[model samples]
Target: MWVDRADWNCCGEPFRIGSQVTWELRRDIDVRWLMEALGSDTAVSVDAFQYHHGDTDVASEQTSGTVARIRAVHWRSAPQTGTVPGSGVLTELNEADRGAPDRGDLTFEGFLVTLKQ
Candidate 1:
């Protein structure tokens, strides 16, 4: 999960930089593959960005026209079972940047946190 400093009400919590915000993967893309494809300092298309209310399990709210920045990429697994079910990455974005021109194209800034399950 992640939080937007400007859209605290949307998240239903106080604004905190780098906070976790709920995200939904629209496609079945490998996190490692996506990280490699994006590389470092490369802009990525925000078309894949889908946001939702943090308090709900069902994806009923969708935030459109936003940008994303890849923060980190790592693999996660259950140490006890040695089962690697999924991986996650963090991304950051500005609430004001939403609906801006070219918002649907690519983004070079903001924060992000992504999880693949």
Candidate 2:
């Protein structure tokens, strides 16, 4: 196979930065949904970025510097499973020099806790 480079989405999908939202796992969900529905949370590690995309919010390329942002859900406190000791990354975005789109995965332990709300 070719040794592909660059993350699945590069710098991250575009976004307006300010208009963003986030969610956490509840204790009443199922791991199956986290797996079958959106894609296997196992195919990739929760630590590794997953998928991403973006587009311009303007009618034309009038604003060249106009940039937005994309987000990902990385499980810091992943499962207390066989994973290495202390795998908590804490998911939070910070002000950036123009953040980009990105994707991510969750470890098995994370998968269990994320949806098992």
Candidate 3:
């Protein structure tokens, strides 16, 4: 499931293996040397930063960029959560479900993304 914690959550559309996606950076990221390091057509894995949760330090609009190519696909799975192995499945909690006491430990998903400026 998506990164659902007291700190942040996912608020964007779900992506697929070949989907082009864009997201904001949690902090300043230096990708100036990416093309040189991985070549123009090469796709590299990077983190899809967390969604803002009203924390002034982790705002959603910090840094955003153009859509980037999905170089390859990798799935994140957990046996307990019964997630599809290598599917990278993530869930976004509805506002009402944010702090439900019945909600116990939840699985989280991480993304490796490329950034296009």
Q: Who wins the TM-score comparison?
A: 3
lDDT of 3 by residue, 6-52 (tens): 43323545444344445444543343333333333422333334454
- Write down the worst ten-residue block by lDDT for model 1: 99-108
Tens-digit lDDT string for candidate 2 (1-117): 000013322443333345342221112223332333234444232222222222334121111222133223233233443233333232233333233233344332221111111
What C-alpha lDDT, on a 0 to 100 scale, does residue 68 get in candidate 2? Answer: 33
Q: Between prediction 1 and prediction 3, which has the larger lDDT?
A: 3
Model 3 C-alpha lDDT versus the unseen true structure: 0.36
Q: List the lowest-lDDT window of 10 residues for candidate 3.
A: 94-103
* TM per prediction: 0.22, 0.21, 0.33
> Model 1, which residues run further than 4 Å from truth?
1-4, 8-41, 50-110
Q: Which residues of candidate 3, in runs, are more than 4 Å off?
A: 1-10, 14-22, 28-48, 58-61, 71-108
lDDT of 3 at 37: 31
